[model samples]
Target: MNMPRPLIPQVMTTPPTAFPARIRGPLLKLCLGAGTLGLALHVFAADPAPVPPATTTPAATATAGAAATPAAPKAGAQFDWSKVPPVTAPSRPGMFVIAPSGPGYYSLWDVVTGNERKAPPVSPNAPYALMTNPAFEIDYRYMEKPGYEPDLFDPIKRIHMGEDFLLSFGGSFWYRYMRESDARLTNTSDNYHLIRSRFHADFWYQDKVRIFAEFLDARSFGQALAPAATDVNRTDMLNLFADIKLANIKDGPAYLRVGRQELLYGSQRLISTLDWVNTRRTFQGVKAFWRTPTFDLDAFWVRPMITERNQFDNWDTKQEFFGLWGTYKPMKGHLVDMYFLSLDDNRHRALGRNGILGDSITHTLGGRLAGDYNQFLYELEGMYQFGQYSNQDISAFAVASGAGYHFKGAPMNPQAWLRYDFASGDNNANDGRRNTFNQLFPFGNYYLGWIDRVGRQNIHDFNAQINLHPQPWATFTAQYHRFYLANKQDFLYNAAGAATLRDATGQAGSYVGDEIDFRFNIHVDRHQDILVGYSKLFAGNFLKATAPGVSPDLFYVQYNMRF
Candidate 1:
């Protein structure tokens, strides 16, 4: 009913290159944002209904049913309750959890047959309970057991405001200490501290009407360089939305959700909440969904929110992002997802091969397949893009695939996986087509390497990792990555999808370098965790030839408590 586990995914972005700098021009037309907005019109078609009788409810929609699951309600089908999680904490009253939440990623098949998903357990660095449900949308109805025992905070989770209205509360806090050498491979070093906190209130009037709102605070200190754009949102609204169930699960369960919200869909390659960063990502818009026992479909139209360091966050009025994502679980162990996404950015003039161009409109169509056979698991996804970026025609694509095996009963519960990823890049600046793939908003750090380099645009990554759960409360992971340029003429992008290095003449050679990372996560308890990690990049020919001749290293220790 909720999400967690691994299925990583990417995009392209901004700055350092040896080529001559291009000057900006006047505004491009708003035709794209104005033109494609019709696609978003369907999202607001809602017929709000009166509060209905109370009944048992399931998880709300997240994104894709790759965003995985029925986007809204496969809520009817439950999970296998007999399997005990290897990691668990005794639930205390007033606290959020008393037992393990169950497998992070499990399908109806796994639930029906007591099968395992054959994937690594959840880790702090990449946490989400039901891949389809972010922490904010968790279904805590299970907490209401027969003769439920009350804890100091128990009353806060389910408060009776009236005869049928139920209001609940939840929040989380995290602190991190970090150090980096050659930050951004700029021949520099620094140390910093970060703190973030969140609080939210959820309201439900029967099973068909609801409202959810969350607050956020994020800050950083003692950094030598200018803080990244996402590092500082002192205080603001993170998620504020309302959900209306259009129909009951028995009648093809459906929902219409509106307002500001966070989105996560298939493997999260193209869309995600991006929780790894202090200021997580969100959007303001409308979403509608419908699903059955084995499938679900989601449609949405929203504007990406712009985070400001000193003021309240606001949606980017110049850009509009919309999409359709669908998922099908053919029996449990196997799940398939398909999606079509579009983005229009009219904030600034787009630099084209010939000169300045008009606004941008990008359209993408992609699909993903994932499942497990006994102890072996596998995933594959492919995407292609078309449309316009200023005066240039857009033609780009990306692919992600991986296979793994879990030694379930083995000591430490060891597991390993190998993966390959590629996204097209443009080789000719004078060409009429823009070939670089836009990662959209994604959790790129999970797949591209934690060092925050090597985006999904114009790049190739061959990587592998091993996970070991040697203790009930601890997890250890180690990964190695080899990166290369898909097209030397295109810029080298970083994890946040910004262009950090480039050799326009193609003299840099394609090899970007090698990175080895190690991390550890300790499950202090169900609601608390600690994470320690380090990464080092061995500069390859590309970095040595184009940017500073430096290899970067990063280290951090973080503590998180969620209730």
Candidate 2:
């Protein structure tokens, strides 16, 4: 057996508690900002100006990059694979059905944020009319439509059952070359290749019942260090679930799904599919949801599926996860989301000053408000957690806020946004109370700078982002981030939510550093995309005081194709 190398960032076991004195001020400001965001949206929605039809923006997972189809594309569908509430996807696109808000794994960025940089291109790779229009890789309902052209793969994509049954196929390939200099300020460098591929089969019966199964194979090669758990999960089940209609709603049907699957929630700050990793994340459980034009609701309970290289994976019986989420669209281009998420884990064992410890249980309650009004947009989310870990009390909080402006017709179709994020940290290690916020499961790569030197724990980030669509087939993004420790005495967390460096005393200073990142995306045609990115981090006083103080640079090129 190969020893597992440390992944870039894994969820932290240190539960956070307390309301730090330093974060209180910013907390108040963020609270006010959230309220203002809601009010402003209300005003815009109430405006007497003639309301325009809901704009259909390219959601994060909207397919693009294929050669333009000679035939005009069909009207795109709004159905997605996310069980959570996402901000994009047309508000009232036909009758609602069981669709993902936006499958976190299928999208490059946070689909919940409506942040896709370019309009999707028409699909030309599929011969069947069912796949003529590009859709997120997870959506298979299109196959139910009766249509076909002579093609080997087309038959596998749509096989008719006796009467109402239909079977479909879906899959994709993602590859990347990763290289870094002075990673973690260790004054070391390495280059490696990562490859992750997936295939799935979807079977449906009269749109009332279904079975979906997906398989994954991920690998890493030519690395100086052993591959992390995230890099290898050879021949494993990614998703295997059964769905049954519970009731029929206006535009769709409510569903109760059971088995192994993935979970994604609003903003994906706490619960996500963890798609950035080679193997990604999944769980064995059940989920129930109903999607409609006016509102959406979901509930679920599950155990995280453990990934094992060269072995059959199974659910970790020691943990339990459950959540409830609801989204309301009060007016066009605006939405509100509320959720409650909790986890119970028996994984951590430690000795207190006294005896053996107990299990860890944590709960998170939060809400988000977001909207797009006349090229101005904003998103705000806040979460507070209280629980028990190893007999210690836990209390923690996190907030993320962003405001941006979109230039629809300006040069380069540019968009600029300013964002701020904060998470609490524990002041004393042995204080019996933890304040460092556990990130849970998240798409940390997108929230923090891509250099991945930091995480959404014990940190404060002031960042700015600019996105540009320079051509029909290309997009560019640039970002600058300034980071500081929420509590100078807390540990400095890596993007994986693990504490790699710390200053027990408050003397090292809170300044973590600055990071600049740039990325370019190009679409060869519908099934292929190429991405190039570079990131540089400037060492701050905190590192100089605690470690080597060496800054790091990272570069990567990625390719993705779906079939």
Candidate 3:
């Protein structure tokens, strides 16, 4: 007969790995905060119940005048404890022990098991030892032992209000070389650099409340070469917000946030922080977040923060923005996003098709579906706009779609993708309806092309891209794009929302031009990255008919680091 296997008892314990030497300083600070949290939990965690004594099988006894039958052998004989080797106790407390219990099973327990004494009844000022529970104990693996070394002021880590806080500082420097031939009137070129520095701090209160703030100083140098690239700003407050945990749900917790912050949604087609720009976008607002394992929802009401060339930036009180964004991930690698946004602007420039300048209100409804399955990936998005612009009726729409495939076993881990985009334009200037699509605030450079010469309004874009990872740290990309006017009568708008070319007579052809771009990225290390890129555009018939159709060329090299 086969002997029954004994089931081993398991204990929940922390892992044994320690933080690496290089990051020990930062990790220690994190641990200090965690240790404070552990202390707080100790004050609240319930006392563990008493451990029962080890159970033993009673020996068989013969009754008076009755012969005791030999105890029937256990159905599956247990190992004789006398014949088994004894386990040596751990040399230190809190160390784990794994002992063989029977065939194919093991028992895991702490060396101090059964020896721990029960705690006294609760008291207002209990001794530290009474409040110290192993479940709430701080793992020294994540931190240096207390009194192991002298204390030092770490900028990135601190303790305040009996709680743990963190403070950090970081910055980036960027340089670009830009040249354009026959840019409407003259050939122009410029070399400029941008310095962006920021300081951030986070304050937490027992995982229930958090306050965050960041200050930024972004400025441009050598901009005199091209006065048009004035994306500079003096020192200013970027983000200041308070996040409060509202309640716990089945999958996770909900949060309410208020104050000045950055708002970014899927793909950033309609709303974004636009971090690529020297002075990024931000908003003063109230936002609510509800997240679960399968879905997330965000709703907000805000006004855009206007970047004043002056030292202190201000909020645009006359303009209000509100939106609801939600994403659903029903399965791994698949995602769907839906959103509705409303913008109300009191500025005079936000006018209507009838040429009246007044307040404008626009509402946008859109959704995106994207997924990656096996080696194939796809994305699709569509948006429709309606409302009132001054006296005219507002109506417009846009669509973007992309598909790609990865060659799993191919050299270089190559992948290829194709994408197309379309945005509506005013069909007839005389019409009372405004049809030109508004891009709102977006990362236009990423969507239009590497050259970033066109806006996402009244345009048609077709693009193809090839990507290769030549090494674990290096990537190469080649892209081609064809541009066209969605409507012949509409103006050719640039990324800055300016008309680069227009044919009032509506005789200009639709074909704009074709562009080719090549780029390479190298992630030198965890803290450093390098990028190099070149792009060339071949002028088409419409460009030739409207002005000097000189082809444009661009090249740039960039390096970035963080600490």
Instruction: Name the candidate that leads on lDDT.
Output: 1
Among all windows of ten consecutive residues in candidate 2, which has the lowest summed lDDT? 92-101
| Residue-level lDDT tens digits of model 3 in 1-563 | 22111111100121214322323343344345434533433332233222211110000010110111113322333322111111110010000001111121000111124322121111111111111111101111111122222212233332323223322233334444444444432355545666666555665554466676667677767643444433766777677777788876544456777777777676666776665566677877777776554555667667788786555666676776777776665565566777777777778676555566767777888988876578776788899998777777789999988887767666666777789989888767547788988888775665676566778899998988777756434557787889999987888887656667778677878888898988776644333456678888788777777766467777777655433
Error of 1 at 212 (Å): 0.8
Ranking by lDDT: 1, 2, 3
lDDT of 2 at 198: 83
Per-prediction TM-score to the true structure, in the order listed: 0.78, 0.77, 0.70
Candidate 1 per-residue C-alpha lDDT over 251-343 given as tens digits, one digit per residue, 9 for 90 to 100: 244677777788877676788777678888988877776654445567776779889777777778677677777665555456677777878
From the highest TM-score down, the ranking of the candidates is 1, 2, 3
Kindly provide the TM-score of model 1 when superposed on the true structure, using C-alpha atoms: 0.78
The ten-residue window of minimal lDDT in model 1 covers: 89-98
The count of backbone overlaps in candidate 2 is 20
